[model samples]
Target: MTLTESVNLDNCDREPIHVPGHIQSHGALLAFDAALRLAACSDNAERMLGFALPALGADLDAPQFAAWPHVTQAIGDFAQRSHGTSGLAERSEVQVGGRVFDLILHFNGRLVVAEFEERQPADREIRPFTTLANGALGRLRLQRTIDDLLQVAVTEIRSLTGFDRVMAYRFRHDASGDIVAEDCRPDVEPFLHRRYPAGDIPAQARRLYVINTLRFIADVGAAPVPVHTAGAEPLDMSWATLRSVSPIHIEYLTNMGVAASMSVSIVIGGELWGMIACHHLTPMVVPYGKRMACDVLAQLLASNVQTLLAADHAKRIEAASSVRVQLMETFVGGDGLLAALRPHAAALCTTFAADALVASEGTETFVHGGVSAAAGAELLRWLRSSKPPEGLLAMSEQAKLPPVLSAALAPWCGILALQMDDNRHDWLVLLRPEQVETVAWGGRPEKVYKAGPHGMRLTPRGSFDVWRETVRGIAVPWSATELEIARGLQAELHRAGGARRAQVARDRDQMLAVLGHDLRNPLQTIAMASQLLARGADSATVGPRITRSSTHMARLVSDLLDLSRLQGGLGLAVEPKPADLARLVREAAQDVTLGHPGVEVAVEAPPQLQVPVDAARVRQLLDNLLGNARQHGEAGRPIVMRLEASATQVTLSVANHAPPIPPESRDRLFDAYKPASLNNSRNPGGMGLGLYIACEIARGHGGTLVYEYHEPFVVFVVTLPREARAAAAGEA
Candidate 1:
């Protein structure tokens, strides 16, 4: 197989660590068949358990195991628990041969497996777990910053675990890590502040760290005993605390001249944030009690770290908010929007720690600091046309940029741009200068290969040499706080612009009201003159034609006046009185029939349904609904008007068979001057004012007008309260 394929097979993610056919020398494992007869055993079982290897098929009740009754009983209990489970259970400490040993039992298919590890006696001076945990926590609470907190953690862990070195390692954004804090012996070489490549800890290894919080390896130089089994596949030991370490990792530690090691994971926000790695120069075993104490300490540290980071972020946001307020005040006091921002451009850039700033609106461009005029224009063009996501674009590296943009934006490698307005080509751009630095790596990061039994295989780097590399074409990264502040500024600008537009709309509506009132006098005069001229015999036809045109003009003018009043603060005017709504609907329907011949009008109403309403306004509401139905309803189809009265309210429904309204048009259907369709030919002679006026009249009487587009029909409903005065008072 190719070396790449070999590397992949041995990759921690794909490695068959569960069935590795191996076990640590510190433990002895044995397997038995369904009949409780010995099936297979690890090579060291005879030395550790005092069991003969040649007697593999011997029954469990044989004379040889009579001295170890506790071992047999423990195995029996484990078998019963593993029956319906995943064939695994927790380790139990038992006494055998006048010594304490940890026993682990599991079932692989039909074969029962048992592992045993002898435990060493604890020192008399070792402190109780509660005492140690309390002292560690007390020390941890004294820290005020992340650096201080991490330093305390490494020191406390080293003292508790008795390791030669304890380092607080933190992962960067790209998965690489650096030794941020260390507590080690004076004779050992320091790994503090040194960087390690992401590949040094593979993805699967990192995931395992999150699952199994603490891992301990007593001796890296010891041989791994083969786990013999009758079945072709080996047992899965992923949760085994005594599980054998990977071969590559052993070599890695050996090269560092480390005899043993242990690591505890530091989790934050439910993710693998970093680790507290400890190395020992000699073989050393940490008892389960001590390991538990370390785990508790790590968890406490994670909680404190989260709180400190949040507080730091809040401080940054407060500073940014102050800067934003100053810029906004400048805009409000200036002669124009662009003029307001130009003078404060340098301060705006500095808020985000950028070296240059550029603001562009239409043909006018303002540039400050290091950016050239040509580069600013080119960047503006890209910002407008590219349409980056969230109206914000950011890049930290220039080497990875597209060639066309790189050529024009040299030296200024990084950019953070925010579009100021959605309707215009205006933007605010922040430029950062290129930053160059050299990074020190532990060793050559590239894969190295060597000839092996399988042809070729990858091997860990043999040397721990320091390799330095110079990086260019990248700038210092922008923090999360800066991006959040940019978004906040965009939102404030939008709010201010909306307020300005609303004022302009109010001015336009007032002007229309005045113009509509002025045209009324001329139209009234035309109507009166036409009627007087109709009395003459010679001008009879011409006079009548002029009268019809003037009457239509007068109705149009009245509609304009009502619409203007409705849209303004003063709503519809109404005087309510007891009236028969049925009579009003019939009269309106008759008028529609007269206007359009051959169009059927059907009215379904009770004999007498009285409600408190304005007679003229109700008639107007009915007339507008009928007119809308006649204009849009399909030809030769009947229009239905139904009226129903209840204890509290009365409902009037007008429905017709016509083409369904477009989904997009339904929302603004009642808006003045907003036609159902943009095509004028669809509903010719429609001023689009009918529905708007109908809605206003309904509101005046404490009623509502609504439309629904059911298949094969378009329906409009107007509902009015039975007690109009009570409804109007409640609304007020």
Candidate 2:
């Protein structure tokens, strides 16, 4: 009956207004009248905006409503009925505040009725030149080393524009596509390692993923591409959703839902290589500029992928023919082919963060990188299971690997499986992605799988791994230039493997020799010290001597243990603070003097020369140098000790009257088990581990321990590189 009720009826489509009894009964009509007028349309509606839009009756007297400059002048006339222009209907789309609206004007009786309909911002920028340049240049850059090149391109773009998840969605022969490279959400599990089957994306939808170089579905629930076209001809199967797709797409998504999706195709050489997919958990309406920026990013990625892949193809030829020929001489029937190709692995394959050239012999495998035998076994199992009879098969599903293997190889995210033989000569060159987020696309819909009673079930658009292309055939024909490079690499790896084996043997021999000789001297020292004490000397004299001898003996044992710990990769536990060098020097001198009563040990250090050093290690260092000087150098010459402190380095030099070491020997004087006789000591007691251990200790604290072969006096200097005095002062 009232204006409010009339308006409500129109919206409700003949249904009665459902106002609550409690909110009605009194002054309802008055309150509802104001509410109905206010709610007739949006605040900007022409009917509600009288100040901005002149009343229909006042149009003749009112200043003519200034036609928007974007609209055509004259507007074709709204009041020439006799001239057949009165019934003219005019409608155009207008943009205001990044939103588009359909502006319609109609002549009714003697007045004009104007209405506006909201239109989505689905219109694209018409920059044919920009698009052409991007498409052309982008495709060229992408084909080089497609794997690493795409990853880098995606990473750089993602950084430039912050996107939650970005990926490289690669197309397959089947209509479906998979996200091969991805930078995923921080808390979510990585989706880099799995392949999505064709069923994952419907045939028609996938066609769009490839054809539509840049497609944005802002809000799936709101703006949908209508499939109905009255005059359209029969759709070809190749077209994406040309006819009509089921509502199941929305239901299927709602079941395993993605709220928003933005896909940018990676087209190389006019063929769709892949797409950059950006996803969102909640509904998002992307800004026009943002979408354009992503399109530009995709163009860059496409170019890089093409460039890099072409380079890879060339490299593969070089490896298979030329490199293979060279490898034949060294490896024969062995898996040494992969070992020969390692030096170029970094440059040739940039997607890999770390790599290993592993040789498979039967079930057993040998690794050339820093992998242990146990680790090698795990790696071999993975490669053998997936590798082809010949050539390479790249795998990106490292995260889904077994716990043991994945735990050990947590650093690498991908693997390149290459088979060299039917027997005991298969090789796996593993590749680790630099960061988990490098290859991600910006518009891949998030897939969430529901957890079942047994375990998690993978659902459509749910979290899973992805791999682009895993080629299983041999290198497709080789060129002259390619053969030469491959052969060179193969030869190089063969030589390298031999050199590696030789070095390992030499290291093993050195360790064994050091162990045998170093272990014996301490036992001998302890036995001699015990024998001397057992002889008939006064308990007062013998007891002190025995203690002093035992102290040095204990020091030998401790040094050996510490050296073992360092060599075994255990870090030193340091509790550093300010320490006085003079006090430590005096204490070390006193300890050295306890055993040798006849020798006069003197310390010439400044009283207040303070330095930051590990007190225990410094004391042991001074003790060993002084002891070596007394036992090997001229016993009569005073073991002069001087401590010098500069702004950055604290130097403790111990000089003794010993023959100058040979130039060659000086370089290796601090090496473990190197004969101490090089310092002109006839009786170089204790293992050569003393200086070696000392040097290790010094370096651990950002310092150096070097032996200077000064004429007549070989000086062992411990230089501790420290923060500047000004820095120390600042901290203080």
lDDT for each candidate structure:
0.75, 0.50
Kindly list the per-residue Cα lDDT of model 2 for residues 635-698, writing each as its tens digit.
6777778888888788888888888877766545665545433223354335556677777666
- The TM-score, computed over Cα atoms with residue i paired to residue i, of candidate 2 is 0.35
TM-score for each model? 0.58, 0.35
**Which candidate ranks first by lDDT, i.e. highest?**
1
Best-matching candidate per TM-score: 1
Candidate 2 positional error at 632, Å = 6.9
**Which 10-residue window in model 1 sums to the lowest lDDT?**
1-10
> For model 1, what is the error of residue 143's alpha carbon versus the real structure, in angstroms, after optimal superposition?
1.6
Q: Alpha carbon lDDT of residue 706, candidate 2?
A: 79
